[model samples]
Target: MAQDSGAPEPDDKLHDECGVFGVWAPGRDVARMTYFALRALQHRGQESAGIAVGDGKTVLVRKDLGLVTQVFSDADLAAMPGHVACGHCRYGTAGAKGWEAAQPHLSTINNVIIALAHNGTLVNFDDLRRELIDMAIPFRSNTDSEVAAKLIGYFTQRGHRLRTGIAHTMRMIEGGYAMVLVRENALYAFRDPHGIRPLVLGRLGDGGWVVASETCALDISGATFVREIEPGEIIRISDDGLRSERGCRPLTPANCIFEHVYFSRPDSVKDGSSFYLMRHRMGARLAQEAPVEADLVISVPDSGTPAAEGFAQESGIPFGTGLIKNRYVARTFIQPTPELRQMGVRLKLNALPDVVRGKRLVMVDDSVVRGTTSLQIVRMLKEAGATEVHVRSASPMVTWPCFYGIDTANQDQLIAANMDLEQIRSRLEADSVAFLSTEGLFACVPPNGYCTACFTGAYPVQIPRSFYEEKFLPGYEPNNLAPASKTSQMTLVQAEELLGQEG
Candidate 1:
């Protein structure tokens, strides 16, 4: 959505939470340090901020709806001081955007209590919620994070200790998740078996240990990057170093593709691949797969620039700006209505008449979900006198709601999921439109791993038979998305062949 840089335009709906940070030490002002960590992660989320700390035996939490700076008065931070702290700045995507559902959920079971903060989602949330309700489990907040906490509590009654309880929760969990849990004197860091989510370990020179969703946060906290928590692995950390264990069962890793494409900081290195380099390669791959003749190439904005560069390098097309974005516009995608959305998009981006006038332009965007912004940008380019506009997407067309934490788009809300390319091009009113093949995207990742279910409808884990809004029949066979009658499915062998072809 476009909005005047000087105007404080308000948006609702679209939000991205910044990140999570946790630190454990025998004794210190951990809450004070948590405030600083949240400050550094401020870029990831701006809607609400919180800090929950445990001083070995007691857990104290304070969270509210607002920017980190707005929520943390010096008094507020110091008033809630402790030695072990877990902090979150949330942009509400799945749960109610109210204070009641904020992160650092506290729950107790079998007389043991745990305070949990998580990055990512549980694929089996609805089913679990239903089962818990059936068993008369009471719930206060409507959030998957809370659900996770409750699941751990539920399993604790089955005679599992903290580690065993966490392992049991892991067995119940599906989809992308990296969670940090504080129980008693220890901090536990665990990743989903599929490794769809990212978890990083860092060490403070002063014998402190921190676990966070990304390495960038660790750097900001002056913690040295230890390593990525492996997929299907759990590491329990305390002052006595770390004792790593594995998930009871293992699943193949399928890291979310959008992390490299849009979500993560360019400075972060997920698994083993550089986020910046992967995105740059995505652009290059897009150009190689969908090259077209145009007078010049322009990216959607900052997110599109790296790939745009790659596209230019590979397509031999001179890249230049046809549109200029106001750098100061703050969070306008929050607009509640279509009229406001269009207005905001126009306000954020204005066409550069001098550069684009009478030129054939190729535009690159990271991904298109609602198509509202894409249409507005297209109209702006036309109004700027671009004779022809060709649109290319760096990532494959998003065809499904991310079951993981991303929550990018819903099944029916996705234009690509429901429409063919020709229909989308016509709807967006572009001279031409192209999407990177799923195979093209496979070649984009550095082989760290990928979850391409958004484009391929091939979930890394089995999804629930039903959502609250939609009922899916478990008996119904999946749509078998293989290329032709010559195939049963895009098996690993076929995917490898497609990857080779795209490369």
Candidate 2:
């Protein structure tokens, strides 16, 4: 939905692209299982929700522009009985918005049908789309996800197995992605070579299997977490049992570090540690690095609560709630009147005067994006009688844009990209402002190769020159940490020859 001309600006934070889930279980209500899983993964996206089920004969899909609960009624789930299914909830980063762009994108290859849900941006999709269009392939949406589904279908129809088609397609797409696909009789899951986006494998009751973008989805669906889907790996689950294949050669691991700082739910576990623990550690580290004298440490709200608690514990300050969020205020189509528009952040959050009055406050938030929301929040705290409001970010300053699944602004709109620490503090009108150091952020998470591009301006994948030219300002340049590996971008002829050799 387009924002009204006079609507209040959105919160200054990065948005993740989407969440994907797949399940393969006979005798289970696969549709309902997917529905619940999508609910758990809802935080990853809110623009649209969809589910596709393969009932042993044909793939059936239902999708629309709304939250998961808004899109799927109990009756809708009951209507889509199947043994295998895939679901998607999307906040589109690489496509136009509308019902057409809602995913679990469906396509046909000969007599076979498949539905796919994807969770990242494809940096080279524009070129690939043009290539496919030149080949007379039809397209329903401008999303890279549709390109993927059709690309897989195109390869499959040319006398290749579905898994091989998927493998070949994986070799062609460039960017951070985790995808879940469902055909009439099986479920497939795959990830990009760098593992820049997350996908987890899980075991359902004795005979079932599940894959999702996060462990929280698996938890809600009564699935036990097994392990992460390896980078460049393809997982196929069918009646014959589970199969895993190396769809492409794995490159240096570059998992998105933001997952620990903000994206994943605090309760979600990664590398044997809960995100909550990692964020808490980040808070402690932030406190050590940027200590301040304040009577109370308060969080921006739900996302910042864990870090705020740790900050309080480490600094020996009392932790209290100075701001209360209106839980029911989600994205709305209804435009607020001019008076309400001026209220801005107040529509979603309100200051607790009884808690903050006359106290010096240290307010911790997960991150600072454009700084507009932070400025309003600081003003609100002061208006509520706080003597001072110190803003602390648990994550490092986001100085660069993300071309992966995250919906970050161009460099010009990112406050950190344009301002130094002192300038940012002045801009936000906060008594003080501090961000966690990049090195400190890395210390809090598990020891694994991570994508710190947003903090360091070092990209793991080679962005298309066109994309780079379009996204970066004139004076800015990016550091290509690792370009696309040779084997990752296979030619059609090479892919065909390899498939023939396997045959």
Point to the candidate with the largest lDDT: 2
What lDDT is obtained when candidate 1 is compared to the true structure? 0.73
Stretches > 4 Å off in candidate 1? 1-18, 25-29, 39-44, 109-113, 134-136, 157-160, 332-342, 468-503
Predicted candidate 2 versus true structure: per-residue lDDT over 90-179, tens digit per residue? 985545889889989988989988999999988888877887888788988788899898879876766468988898888888999999
**Reference-based TM-score, model 2:** 0.97
What is the Cα-based lDDT of residue 355 in candidate 2? 98
Model 2 accuracy (lDDT, Cα):
0.90
What does candidate 1's lDDT look like per residue over 1-503, in tens digits?
76545533332122344478888865667777788878777766777778887766777788887777777888887787566788887766645678777778888876666788877776557666766777789988777888888877765555346666576667665656878887666778888876777778899888888988778888877889988888878788776778898854555667877777777777887657777787788889888888888889999987778888889888899989877888766443244465554475776788899999998898998777667778878898998899998988887787666666765535666677667899999999998898877788778777666777767667776655454235222222333222121211233235334334534
The true-structure Cα RMSD of candidate 2 reads 2.0
